[model samples]
Target: MLQSSPKGSSSLSDNDNSSDLKSTMNDISSQTNENSDYSILPMDVIVDILSFLILSKQSINEYCNFLQSVHNKNHHSIFNLFFGYKHWDIHKTHVVFLYRNFIVKGDLTPYESRNPSEKVEQDGFIMNYIFKHAHTLTVDYCPMTDTYCQSLRKNKRIERFTFIGNRKHYHSGLCSALRECESLKKLKLDSVYDWEFTKLFELASLTYLKLNTGMMLRDFPPQKYNFDFIVDIEENQGSIKKILKNEFSESRLKHLSLISSEGFTDEYSVSNLMKLPALEILFLENQKITKQSMRTVGQSNLREICFERCLNFSDSGMEQLMKVKLPNLTKLKLSGCGFNTSNLKKVFEPSNGEILNQLTYIELSKNQNMKDTAFSKLGSFKFENLDTVDLNHCVSLSSIGILTFMRSFSECIRTLKLRECNLDETALVTILKSCSKLQRLDLEMNNISCTNIEICEITDLSNLHYLRIEKNNLTDIEWLIALPLSNLQLPRKISNYGTMQLDRQIP
Candidate 1:
């Protein structure tokens, strides 16, 4: 056992701190017997451990807020009010520790007033120590003003960079500074245009890229005729493909999230991404995808793919993609799409009389066309590997489909979501009785019309902790009251039925 050393004054210098540390180690050494394993520790090993602790930049209480008022948020706010958002005030002789992240939100402060270079280089930081230590930098709602541009010019250690701003930020200096980040690896930007896309070509280490808000927006959107939306499919296919190929030519980008209405057309743009040697996880959200687009996806080597709210990816489209046998795919989320029972049957039963046996998690939510037939072909395949199943908002599914799925994967499935699916009393009863191993159960908006529910004595929902039966009409509380609910999360709507507490632990 080690003994506590006497507390040193906060004004202790580096030499004093080192002396105190050595004294503490000597005390430990003195207490340990020759037979003790700790007594055999090499002096070099002890020094190395202490060195790592000092170098890791972990802010303990003393390191974070020890002696100075510099660590106080109010002091920083007061300083920001007078001058600008900044770190240490060196004129006050305040010693500051290393910071892991630096964020700038432009909404609170006016863009024009502050000179960020003066704040970063002169008043606040000494030798740009703060930026040197910070690895992650987030610039949200901030345009490419000269202030931030000059500030970011000194960001040599930042690895993950996120910039969320509108399309109006058009400063060439800002663009050049971001493009020249030699240490940058992951980037998430919003409202990227054709001109902005070219700025990313210089980043050689970028791996994860997520560009939101329609990357290819046409300049002159056509007048309202058949639809009021801007269409860029035919005009920007080649433009998008050319930019992507050039941008990622030498880059080893792995995870990519791109908008896919006109962004993914015929095998032109998405196929370009597949050519990337390390590209794996892809997110294509909220678009009208065609068979040609699906064809490109089916042939890719993506480990995980999500097609959320792509209405044109119908039953036929999903079936064709599934038949191709993507051995690399482990997680497939086709939520809010057009897939239903008929085509989704291939997902539940395939690969030598078993289901898509490789999939660990499959989400088929918001498919209103799903019915009893969707689960009709489900076999007792090795579903032990499948952990989560989400069929939320499939209102067309009756008790038959719900029952079939629950009976098949009750023992294996840990998280089951069937919210807004219009479940009745029989479905409710079956769920509690069958899905005993469920850790999370979401039966929200089901409105099971049961004024008096019979709590089944034999039901084994012992493992269930999270329950979201919100906006439901199951009035009976005896069944819920009987379970071993140590930390059960009940919906506020369920409390209206009886004297039940809504707040358990914000699940």
Candidate 2:
């Protein structure tokens, strides 16, 4: 302790350096405090800047990306906002990324074994994030994801839901998900087999449902890939009855789209369908259900039915369909259907002493089997409320049918589309004379003769508002100047100045 030598002097020097370092640190701290005060701005000014940035398209995209990384709930909200617009390209490059993130955020993976408690915590967390404002959501073909499903549990706002199961996977979870969507009004399930259809009754608000392309095969049978499985006739009838019984008694369902699960074999299924008292619009496509079966389906509270490519539905079905009293029905479409002259005739025939008096619209395009007889049948009915009718590609039909059909309903019918119908000079003259109240007419690709004499006679269309007379052998159309038609659709042709004064041409 008393030694005062060179070593002791070095120790004292070290202590002095340590004190200098501490003083320098204190000075740096004081400088940092001054800089922080300078950087501070008013909260309102900061908020204004944030608002401007948030509203910018680029900013919204960036925020969504950032939010996706931090919270699933925020990501779902941002995703919905971005999709709300009709067109948005921000997610094009990052679609796969977004898909992956949706899976991770929802933790919606398939079950290792069936039990609710297995991933309850993860499912709840995912549900909390996804259920905020998504009224419609699709859970399609993502085999490993089941996390997002639980988020839908007890959600009050979801009205529409779609689930598409993978070919090899089980769709038990989809059934589970449906039970939770209590507010669901419209539902579509694709590629699901043996679905307990009765379970849908729990969704009391459901009004529309589409079931397409399901299978019961143990493996991917190549031939049956696009096919659906059929339930036993008794079971199918019971299920349909249950659907009708519960649907009207408990719920407010009005519209239903039933894509056939398979070719319906049960007469009971057909019979039970008519009991749905609340059903209004039914869209049946790609079905094997025949006209006989349709009578029962039509007997239900259905008003309108759209038939497309259901091959078995021939003229017989049309008769039965017409027999069904649809007081509120306004529209019917038979596009691409196999209807012939017999069915076409029924369309104009007065159902029960008065043409479906409430029927205002009818579309029967591409029924190549229709002809003059069909037109004559139409002349018998009074389409007092009819406004629009389309007979496009009815190639077998000639002018005789066209002339009479137009004359019969010309008083009420304003719009007529007869594209590609086989027409001649006689038919054209008859239509011009009969359709005085016609506002729109399409005679495209027809065989109507275009002689100067015939063209002169065409001036009678004074009430015509829209006219299409394209793809016919016409060298002159001088007679068209009589009407105040605002729209004219005609094919390009070299017309002499004497032919007609060209006001406006739309091809």
Best by lDDT: 1
| Clashes by residue pair, model 2 | 107-147, 108-145, 108-146, 108-147, 109-144, 109-146, 127-151
Model 1 Cα displacement at 24 (Å)?
A: 26
lDDT, model 2: 0.55
Candidate 2 Cα misplacement greater than 4 A, ranges: 1-128, 138-144, 162-172, 188-198, 214-248, 260-270, 294-299, 342-352, 378-380, 425-429, 452-463, 474-507
Residue-wise C-alpha lDDT for candidate 2, range 387-499, written one tens digit per residue: 88898998888877777777667778778898899876566666666676777778878875555234444555546656666677665454454333445434366454223
Q: Residue 1 error for model 2, in Å? A: 84
- Write candidate 1's Cα lDDT for 1-507 as tens digits: 111122332233544475464454345435443453332445664443233222211122223232133433232211222123223322222222223454544443222325677544543332233333347766666555565566577787678877777667544475577776778888887655444444554477878877655444353132211111212223364543222334445667788776633543222334445556577787777654544555544355677878787777777667766755466877888887877676667656635333265667888888888787877676665466677888899989877788877676777788888888777766777777776677777777876755445565444655766777667765676666665565665565643752333335435
Q: Give me the runs in candidate 1 sitting further than 4 Å from their true place.
A: 1-100, 108-134, 150-154, 169-176, 198-202, 214-251, 260-267, 296-300, 351-355, 379-382, 451-457, 484-495, 498-507
